[model samples]
Target: MNIVVPVWGDAYLDTFLEYSLPAQLAAGNVPALEGSGHCYTIYTTAEGRRRCEEHVAVRQLTRFVAVTFKSLEVVATYNAGNKYRTKSDCYAIELEAASRSGAAVAMLNADILLADGFIREALRLLRLGKRVIEVTGGRGLQDPIKTALDSEFREYNRIISISPSELSRLWLANLHPQLAMHYVDGPEGGSFHPSHLYWLAGEEGVIIRAFHLYPIVVKPNASPVKFSGTIDDDLVALLAAAPDERLIAQNSSDLFCCELSPPEHFVGDVAWRGNRKSIIDFYLGYRTENIENLEKEIIISSKPPVGELWDRTRRDSSDFIDTLISDLKSELLRRCAAREADDLMAKAAAEIEDDGDFIKAIGQMLENGHPIPLALEERSLRIHLKTYPDRADLLQRLCAVLGAQGKVVPLELEERALKAIVELHPDRRDLLERLRLVQVGLGKTAPPAALVSPSGEEASQTEVDFQQDAEEFGRAVNYRDMEPEFAPILELARRFTMTSVERMYALYKAVQYIEATQVPGAIVECGVWRGGSIMVALAALRALGNTERDIYLFDTFEGLPRPDDDKDIDVLGNRAINGWLPHARGNERSNWAYASIDDVRSNIGLIDYPSDRIHLIQGMVENTLPAGAPETIALCRLDTDWYASTQHEMVHLYPRLSVGGVLIIDDYGHFQGARQAVDEYLAKTGTPLLLNRIDYSGRIGVKVQKSSVGWLQKLGWR
Candidate 1:
């Protein structure tokens, strides 16, 4: 079916926007109205085509005249006619006009409902009666692949797959879980920073693409003896000459891992082969709305026959009367013209009883297709913006405009050019309440405001010094050690909140988001330098009244892994000359990861957390998470400072996360290098993105069951 949408001015689209939909966009920026295709030109010219093909900027507005249609067999197999039924469905209606319309056969494919059920039924249909494609059963009554994959996904080779930067984050969820964010580098190897999330998602574009619970096998499918140039280009030759056929995946063909570290090999029948467009949503539509068969296009207008005719008929001889009536006619024509006069009158009336903006809207109608300055002049707004008249005049008039549109001056940031009037005048006192807005985040804390002094002024929101407040909060938070006051928060939490989440263990530095009960073994964080967080976690676990489970602290006493063969730069191929971080400026890697695990263990020894309960797995989590596995992991927190360490922990123990288990990632947020590892893992794997944060870059969260949904549209699912 053919669809059309009109593009118009977005009142709240930011020149510099963030991940969470900004308040301006959601609050009042009206959605473009769609009815009949009325206001667009299709991309049809050859030169227009050339401009689209070569230039990104020029091609941006290239709208298509999309058309989707199918033969009898294809139509039955594909579409299932969902688009024709629902009005609010998101599949189409965004399509531009397309140049080509054609029909094709649709082969069936099955998706297993694991990634939101798009292709599942088609594959089932194809398998039932196909002789051309033999269906060797995937599983009889028993599904072996599912069973084998699940067992292998968790704790394979004991190495977790994560990037370097994620290992250096702040608050972790307290267990192994998937997190997605964008953190790759620009030209200078400078990292890109965005608010972090700790939720699960399968495929995200520029973030962690794909990751999940799976065993990691490091051994190559074949011996290292044969050195046949690039395996990708010479796959079949290498496969045929290989010493042992046992290594390849039987009945699987094609080389997905050819460009990888070790080329992937499989000896099998054709796994999957098809035209790329077969997977693309084909906007096939018949030239069904044949205009030749259409009824006459017509519009009915309600009208009162008046004006010159009425004046003449009534013989109104007063010149003043004539001028007054003429002015009335002009005012109605200007404002009530974009769509309807009555609707415009209603809108303006809602804002102001008098039809003043209506008069302006009439002029705006006259100025359509004109330059913006001319349009403003036509509407008479240029004069008002230019001449404030006086402070008294400005205030009264601004108030009148405010009353008319019901718009308020911004209150949060005093220097907002858009909200500057409030900063300069009476509305400043209401900053706290009038600023009833918060970007969506993992927790419920208000994020900081824009730094007025920022050079750009518009895009930057710097972290402010709420130091005294934070100190007070921390002091209050630290009071759990000696008092019964903090129990009230939990009491309040229990009374007011309805969630299964209860505190398992609490540490100041470790991933405390995990709810640990009497778990079988100890809770361990490998690189605990300053005992602050871990002590908090341990104390909280003690506070939660679960004293049975232990807390294990692990680290390389000397600090950091021996910068391996690939450790000189970044996992995504960036140079790391010094320890300088993009966001943290001059802090060294040592500053981030260096800490005496022994010293931390000693300091926490004085707390209510018992020393015998705390075990130190010194070295790397690559060695630790695996060694501690099959020990019934209640919670696993990894805070090593690089990609290698992050990967080590994730691959090793994330799947071992018990039912309703929690895994916390420390550096998934605005941390520069960290989120890259996160985004890459999210995008390329089957794992999901979790918990998102707004104000506090240091966030806390939990994990859910494995998802059938690939791209979850939630706070932190990316």
Candidate 2:
């Protein structure tokens, strides 16, 4: 049968296209021979019409029309003077469109998903002459793909149909004297009520009473009740006199339009009745009316012809007042409970004596399926990891919890777990390989890479130190007892700059490059915060007794220069760059990462290494590098955080970089600008260098020696 879906705002557009429509088509019901000839109408506002058009064209949606509200045939008969106000008003037009199609119209909400052959089953039931068919309630569409994968849906899904007589009953229930808000009877003594729910529920006797539950606006499928039928006898009696015992639902979808009983709270005197109006009753009175030319649109007016209307209005007003007072009291109680929960959380955080109690409480919350912030849970895990590093069971449990919840486990924790796993089964190469791949997929360096010795053997002796070092290195790296001779330099470096596994990995690669390559160039670092990296490099070279190459350190010495707004473009090729400018001065002092030259010198001084070979360029690299850059660079590190600085470094250093020398990029993953700059330079210059990631944030590449520069010149490079 032909369907007319009323579209207004984008409150449910994504869900409608992704899940609802797909579910409908899966039923294999072609409307080619039926009403509207397979082409459905989507009555919407001007903006909505444009969006629909764009969506249809982009997604190539079939059998759907992005129709304007004024274009609907219903407007032709009506006054067409802004009569459509609420969703019900628009739905009325949709119903009229469906009626004219000469087939049973499917009144489905945008959020509802139909099962395969649902329409066929519905048609079969309609042929059996059932006035009303109760459709099966669907499980919440947490993930549409996951829902479709559910093999139980065919047995669980159902179809419902409403006869014309039942439709009339539903319409009247929605437009009664106590339900409708604004009424305007047709000039010819005839009338119609705009009911938003008549399209879903069938028959006059089928009362659609709604009750309240905690509402999370984003999750539309989380209603307390669905497919409710057969009201309790006591509830019927109670509702007859006091209908405002439960709050009105937000929409028809809030509760399923199927055969089930309503919640007991609205039925019993002992139930939690903080005096609230039935949601269905509230919806009916909120918008659109059957009679026009009424007195100030008070929903009910006092007059000889409408005296009963006045009585209904007075009762509704009293119910509303009582609901407000009760709601106020409930709010006070909720606040008090919230304060208690907060006090408990504070106690858990502060008192080490109650650590087990806190852990048990959090575990219970998770087990009960309560919504808790992921960060809070993570903080607890961190505390436990710190207290018991050797607990493999705890680490595994934490990892499983994070994975199930789709949270990213911290690199440090993952490494700690991997180390534990390796120690448990040191000969499990297959497991170690899988774990390494998993770590790489999560954008973290494998722990084995750091634990392996220079002779390519697993450093089993240092495995214990590796576990402790992993956590310490994340915050700050030190050579204390690990390298007693260089502890002074590491002590100074660790205090001044942030440390990470990635930096150490890159430094190791740099040392290898120096030892293996026979390049006649100076060692340079484009961006040195407190000169930690350079200090490490110098100490390594000094220990190796190879201090022939001059180490060039470049920075602002005052901090990062301000960004150039106009010339520093922000985005390129879906990769966001901080700022890229061919020529612009740093003028804005925002939150740019900064460091001073004095701190750099102090860090270098603590190393107590030879200073004759060290070169300090105390200015922005963009200004200083072009004139003062080394003619040939053996090992170059780019730690610049922005696109422009990174671009400048690559352009000046790449050509000057000696063959087989290593080029380390510190912010390859963290800063989009630095990545883009490197990628653009590599692409433009036709370089075949392969970049290998050291960790989540750093990557290193070596300039391969070539027999000819023909490949470079092919891309117009000299």
State each candidate's clash count: 101, 16
For residues 380-409, what per-residue lDDT tens digits would candidate 1 score against the true structure? 432453454333333433433332232443
lDDT of 2 by residue, 243-314 (tens): 222222222222222111112211111111221322222222221121110111111101121344444544
Top lDDT hit: 2
Give Cα-based local distance difference scores for all models. Answer: 0.31, 0.48
Against the true structure, whose TM-score is highest?
A: 2
TM accuracy, model 1: 0.28
Backbone clashes in model 1: 101
How does model 2 fare in lDDT?
A: 0.48
